[model samples]
Target: MPDPFSLSVIVPVWREAPGIESSLKALASIREAGHQVIVVDAGSDDGTAVLAGPLCDRVLVSERGRGAQMNAGAAAAGGNLLLFLHADTRLPADAVTQLETFMTSRSAWGRFDVRLSGRRALFRVIAWFMNQRSRLTGVCTGDQAMFVRRDAFEALGGFRAQPLMEDVEFSRRLCLVSRPYCIHSPVITDSRRWEKLGPWRTIFLMWRLRWRYWRGESPESLAQAYRSDVRNA
Candidate 1:
């Protein structure tokens, strides 16, 4: 059967073997109803590309960076919509259909949903905050599965190859063109990072960074400190 969505799912990955396989399995269950899932490998040392090769439509390699990987995948894609997903994030089953409907109805520039990856009460608050804040500010994270119309995506020149917050930057532009749909079903991201950091501390760091971003600091600088601190701990 011909795919109804004519959409492409782009997953940016780096050193994500453990969670990658599970995420792929979930994505595979989504079926090939007319969409292609491409895993953009950011030079993963964990052999994620090898494992994902047979599962996804295509596995692409790029320098070790999320922005670069996503840009590469978007350039190689042959679909009308480009959905940038994270390696550690799981999309809803009807993600493709919802994206297609939005694109078809309004020719949507781009949209993203809330993230639900943890069971903790604090995690729920943070996730809810992310959803609300993005709607108010036009800034979103990659874990949200940002989907954009092909032409609109190209016009933004894709995501910058920064080490962080490239999703927020691209989304800022997307918001100017159209209001994000904010899909009802949210994407669930792996909570390992936050859990490892201690939930409260992790949420604190996130809120601090977000506050800094609101105060005009570069998101990369804020995120750099947070992610480095996490990796170092």
Candidate 2:
């Protein structure tokens, strides 16, 4: 097998020019530690690819949809480990090393840590919810930046291209065999959506959706609830 440290960080970007740069910056730092970063563009006409320029090891444009873009990007990546990241989220420092420690030993298939932003107070409750859910279900959102062994990823198949909870579904599939890692170091995610929708209200919406999911509501239904609740920019 190739070295476990041979990892590829994949980011699926749409029309997100503002935050993609931050993600690129963090990925650059990860590259400094010896890892490849691939930006998968989903019809991004807003110069998102242009900004990515030299920061990424590869930038491949794909059809719209996060799952499709990610699959296309991962197909072209040479890394043994595949990390799926969001355009608006930042990766943790030493994430590659942390991942190496886990994958080298085959500790767990893969998982993301908690999600946070600069403001600890604002994210305290959010962190609790995310960490608790991850611990219990072995699931992590896209912001947590999920990684998987390349073979396992292909075996389990990639994301579902669903409007909502594709990450959740992917995690569920991953947990069918064993738990994924919930790394100690968390990644910071932009709180702009929460800020626009009111953190408490946003939390409530997510809770409601999760509850509905637990109650057998479909992921599409859950996504529908949030679709009207917040502005997706």
The 0-to-1 C-alpha lDDT of every candidate, in the order given, reads 0.78, 0.79
lDDT of 1 by residue, 1-233 (tens): 53456778888888878778787888775545756788899777888889888888899999877889999999989887888888778788777667767866664555556665778778888788878887787677877888887888888788887776678778777788877777878888778777888877877777777677768887568767877878876
lDDT of 2 by residue, 156-218 (tens): 877777777777778888887567866778777777777777788978888888778778888
The local lDDT score (0 to 100) that residue 49 gets in candidate 2 is 94
TM-score of 2: 0.90
Q: Pick the candidate with the highest lDDT.
A: 2
Error of 1 at 200 (Å): 2.0
